[model samples]
Target chain A: MVDLILGWTGVVLVFIGVFFLFLGALGIFRLPDLFNRLQAGTKATTLGVVSTTIGVGLIAKGWLVFSLALAIFLLMTNPISSHALGRASYRAGVKPYKGTNPDLYAEKVKKESDQK
Target chain B: MRIEIPQFIWIAWFVIVSIATILATIRAIVGPTNSDRAVGLDTWTTITTGFWVILALYFFQYILLSVSMVYAILSFLGVLAIARYLERGL
Candidate 1:
């Protein structure tokens, strides 16, 4: 009975995971600008995919422990990848809010310099 | 008795993943710059890589796990190459 319940739970979780993933992709295509799209796409997918992956790990049973490790690795790496992408985007000169907003990174650097 | 997933559900998952792949393609194609496309492509490859692992698990095929290894290597290369190009203007 427990196994069956877990399996059903896993299925539902995976289905929900898929839905969020679709939202992530839609954010990528439908958002107005690169900044908005990246924020929407990256944030949704990091959590969505990791959640689905864990559900898959649960359903796949005991022998595929490596698969579980990989899923955990993905959970760790997705955020890092997004951080790297954001930094790269900023360095490449993609301005925020169509260049109207102040640059946060530059402001932080200025504040740190003044403190020293 | 052996258990099986409904064929329609399996096919539905495939279609959903494929739609995601297509959307990623759209991002890559319509991207305003190289970095934008690179981000899209990176996520696309990662998702496809995850799909491979899911298929392996669904089939209970141990050999198919090797695909994950290949994906790991390629993922690192994708990120490294893109970062390098972005840094030095390749």
Candidate 2:
């Protein structure tokens, strides 16, 4: 009974993860600009991978330790990489979507350049 | 001992993820700018990590779990390096 419950729970979690993964891909493909794509790609894929890894861990009882560790490592590193990428892209002069109105990062960059 | 997941369920999972992978690849190939390509690559790596985990479960291979973990670490480092290279100089 316990095994049966865990298996079903894992299946459900895996389904959720795959759905988010699909969304991330769709966003990466269909989004208008670099920053928009990065936003969609990073957030959705991070959640998707975390869920998928943990679900796999639950399904395979013996592999739980390593899967959990992978999931944790991904959760920590995915954001840092995405942040670095976004900063780099902006610095490299890839403009955001035209709808982006805040323009705060550009302002901050301008101030820093002026200070220098 | 492998848990008995239905075969159709496995097929469905694989098919969806495969489609997602293809879409991301298309973005990477035809992206308008370098940063757009980088975003596509980033998404692709992440999806591949998840796919590796699913494959490990499907094959019931404990060793593949380790392989996926290593892949995750390497991909993370690769993405970071790419980002740094894009920022100024390598």
Candidate 3:
């Protein structure tokens, strides 16, 4: 009975994960600038991977450890990499989308150069 | 091989993911700037990681899980390297 329940749940989780991935791809296409693109790519894909991994763990015996570790790794590394990509793109002079407010990064960079 | 569920589910999953990948590839190709392409590549790698895990589960081969893990690390490092290069041109 438990196995049957797990199998169904796993299927549902996989479907949900795929939905997030679909949205991520859509966001990439629709978003105007690199910053927004990275935002969607990182956040949605990370959640998708996490849920899918855990769901797979529940469905398969003896895979729980591997799946949990993968989930943790995804959580830890994804955000860091996203930040790096965004910062790099900004520093490399990829212009922000029109109407982007705040521009905190620009102010920080200016402050740092002035400090030096 | 006896299976209770419809095998087409597996095919459908792969097809959906493949479509997503193709869309990402389109973005990469049409991306006007280098950073856009970089984001595309990053998203592609991230999607592939989950895809490999699903493949491993379907084939009942556990070793592929470890391979996926290694692939994830490699992709992460590669993106960081590319980002660094893009940042300073070094």
Best by lDDT: 2
DockQ, every prediction: 0.42, 0.85, 0.60
**Per-residue lDDT value at B67 in model 1:** 72
List residue ranges in candidate 1 displaced over 4 A: A106-116, B1-3, B69-73
Task: For candidate 1, give the lDDT of residue B14.
Answer: 74
Can you list the residue pairs that collide in candidate 3?
none
What is the TM-score of each predicted model, taking all chains together? 0.82, 0.96, 0.93
In the predicted model 2, the residue pairs found to clash are none
Instruction: Indicate the residue-level lDDT of A98 in model 1.
Output: 63
Among all windows of 10 consecutive residues in model 1 chain A, the one with the lowest summed lDDT is A55-64
Error of 2 at B49 (Å): 0.6
- Please list the C-alpha lDDT of all candidates, in the order they appear: 0.68, 0.90, 0.84
Give the per-residue lDDT digits (tens) of candidate 3, residues B1-90: 212447888888788888878878888899999989989988898888889888887887889889889988988998899899998846
Q: Candidate 1, residues A54-111: lDDT per residue as tens digits?
A: 6665666663376667666666666666666766666666656565465568676457
Residues B16-72 of candidate 2: C-alpha lDDT, one tens digit per residue: 899999999999999988888888888999999999999999888989988888888
The most accurate candidate by DockQ is 2
What's the CA error at residue A116 for candidate 2, in Å?
A: 5.8
Best candidate (score: TM-score): 2
**Which pairs of residues have clashing backbones in candidate 1?**
none
Q: What local lDDT does model 1 show for residue A24?
A: 78
Q: How well is candidate 1 docked (DockQ)?
A: 0.42
